[model samples]
Target: MSIEKHDASVPHTGVGSDLAEEPIGNPGLPAHTWRPTDVDDGAAKRAERQVAAMFVGAMVCSVLFVVVYFTAEIGDNQDVFLGLGASNLGLGLTLGGALLLIGVGVIQWARKLMADHELVEMRHPAKSSEEDVATTVAALSAGAEESGIGRRPLIRNTMIGALGMLGLPAVVALRDLGPTPGDALYSTIWSEGMRVARDVLGTPIKVSDMEIGDLINGQPMAIFEVDEEGEPLVEGVELYVAKSKASVVLVRMEPDEITPGEGRENWSVDGILCYSKICTHVGCPISLYEQQTHHLLCPCHQSTFDLADSARVVFGPAARALPQLPLAVDDEGYLIAQSDFTEPVGPSFWERG
Candidate 1:
């Protein structure tokens, strides 16, 4: 529709019956309020200096972050603050300060030195003429002039320096992700005679201990083991690493109820069998068990496995069965792993087919 538009501020622009319309009173702007930096040249200079100081501070923090990343030790017994490790604490604070100061500096520059006058834009036809395009380019140029970036050499130079230094920490952090985990997932600490122990207490499970339908979470005893001199066999990160691969679930069912796969008919003890507790799809713990059907459910994505049938994936996203741990009874009648899993367990990756 090519109809004429009416405006209260410019009623003469309207024609025909639009003249009798009431004036849509101009809410003119909320009086030209001037900031201290806008009215006083001295205050403006101080604001510029303050913004520059913030940028300089950001650069300093970024440099300190790199220094701490190399110099600090992140050992188990390293210095602690309220409970956090000192290396982690220092790096976190410095990087956080670098980011925060840069943000605050940019905000101060915009609020204190950028154009403060308000211009009301009117509603009109969507298409713009060549004159309107020229007016927009001129307004942007005026905005750039009012922002004072060219005249404020100190703020402009320091801001550039601050932005340049921020990338240093990210490059330094890339080093931490290195040292690949080649062939580490192929085997765990579970050897032929290593006893299946209670997860934390290291209590060995005897063949007579569990009844049919009973399920117990277990791990290789070597993780909680003590040396001949009574020191821990594995501690800290090493202990966690071993536990991740050696974790398992022990379930007992009737021999008639089980369906052993291929040559693995003798992998279980009495009515009991053991499988990795870690799920095949992304390594979530498989805890939800239905003893009746011998189905183990991974709570993460509902991947179900038929434990009786060699832990085969009966449903969901897992590409393979839960890896089974061959079991036996030591002469002492305690449950032990016959050997490490025949193949790698848990989630697969490009390097592991």
Candidate 2:
């Protein structure tokens, strides 16, 4: 499309010239260009087949996504491709190709097959009258008819099949939500005699290692334990899952400053106390400590718990106190857990009675 230029030297002497002078002549709509598919029946048929082929390709990709999701190994036994996991690479390419093909096919259908008439919509008030609403409905019906969806069985059927195939991936993904958590959320790797070790380095912590107002991010020693072969007892995804649930924060304060809850008189050793690092509100690791107040703040939601008072929720959105792990001195003077947490850790769930 090209715009026609107007000469400013010419004086406006037309019917509306007395009211206002025209700075530039209004350029009307350009001549409509006809596509080969619009004029030739053979070209239109070929375009229809090309669109159907794309929809078929989309269906194939969607099917491949489901196949890769089930057959591809994940976690420790995962296969590698170009320095990335094969499962991830395959799933991404297949799903992405499926979406891309569908989008391209829709664009091609509109450009080559749909009604090519150039229309100009006049500006109107925001409010639509009843007659305008009826016209809009009629226009939509006309558009559907012009698109030839009812006449093109191949394109319509293949497109529907491609869209239906997309749902298979979603259905397959639902499996990840389960093997139902069962009693897993109610307990963690923590058990009798599991020593409290510092995070990352995993070195066991002794009472002497902590000072007044000191806070240590710790985890269960089992994560660091090695087998007779010198390999980690827990590795890969298993290690991650264990660490997330069994993580703890050790805090030390004045012995008199501590207020033990009912049945938790012996839960702490000396002035040192241990609580689940996971926030009670959402499960974000809570390590932001205010030593003077003995409060543990969750950075994610600002849920604060008073470590000096049975890890009680003193402020913010936490609905319950942080779960305390019963502490005991091992034969080697390292801090050890007396048992698993008396209650479930992390955010409360529906079945948590």
Candidate 3:
């Protein structure tokens, strides 16, 4: 068949006609500019030094943390800071600076030294041809080569070693968590004649000092008193541990309101009685009280105990009653421990024997 020509005045809608009308050709890519660190030897060297300095700072901070842990006394009035303990301040600052330095170092290395390139990839259908898969694998291998991870054995090994060493501090610190409590929870420093004192402040309590319906959180006088030499009485980790376990609540009820437990007839002096402040439910300190009902409540888990009935668990999830510390009056009329608690304090644990 012979082809017929269209009129010149007509608009064209043919395939070759569309190609001719389309945007002329590919615009092609913009020129690439290399970073100073990539082109200049001096800039690369400077960036490398800056990154090394940050890592060195991190190492120094880590060392300082270990030093502070040993040198700083944990709870001496001597180590007081701006109302915070100096020991805590030093530990927090050193450890935090170490982590911050590592983070900053990584950011600087990436920004000032590492390669920077912008890429444009064409979107395609989800399925790929076998050739595309091969190309992808080759690209990944090329990227690894460009990253220099295999070539730079020193940096690779150093990074691995540093990260591995970080685990050592954690393991070493676990030593502080335990040799286990042993029978410490079952007993305290509250021996016979040891005066009951305010927790932390350590002021001795007299029967006359407390008013009826009053509850004062207290600890043993041993925490504060010095030996004959005038040296610190309780000077180490043992002191803090003792103070924590020996905490008590001294409550004064009317003589008529007191009903002592069996074998606890003389535990109170003129209706002022003492009980272990540590809750039996989960070991939270208990002090919330209903003076009228003589009921003591643990704030955690709402474990209620009847203080009048020997601190029996009257309600809530408490598995056992609060432990009562037997009390007596010393020669000076200060409230004293008749003995250490007859039962374990705080949450029940195995080996409390």
Best-fitting candidate, scored by TM-score: 2
Per-residue CA lDDT of candidate 3, range 237-261, in tens? Answer: 8888887788899888887787778
lDDT of candidate 3 at residue 27, scale 0 to 100: 41
Stronger candidate by lDDT (1 vs 2): 2
Where does model 2 exceed 4 Å of error? 1-54, 68-101, 111-113, 116-134, 150-154, 169-184, 199-203, 206-215, 252-258, 288-293, 299-301, 349-353
| Per-residue accuracy of model 2 over 1-353 as CA lDDT, tens digit each | 11122345533222222224445443553456889999999999999999999999999999999999999999999999999999999999999999999999999998899987643333346899897899889878978998989999999999999899978878888888867677889999999998999999999999999999999999999999999999999999889999999999999999999999999899999999999999989889888999888888899989889899999998899899999999999988999999999999999999888
Q: For each candidate, what TM-score against the reference?
A: 0.62, 0.67, 0.51
Comparing 1 and 3 by TM-score, which wins?
1
Per-residue alpha-carbon lDDT of candidate 1 for residues 107-190, written as tens digits (9 for 90 to 100): 999998886765434455689879778987986897788778898999999999999999999989988996667888898889
What are the runs in model 3 whose C-alpha is more than 4 Å off?
A: 1-176
After aligning candidate 2 to the native by TM-score, how far in Å is the CA of 231 from where it should be? 3.8
Error of 3 at 12 (Å): 40
Report how far residue 99 has shifted in candidate 3, in Å: 22
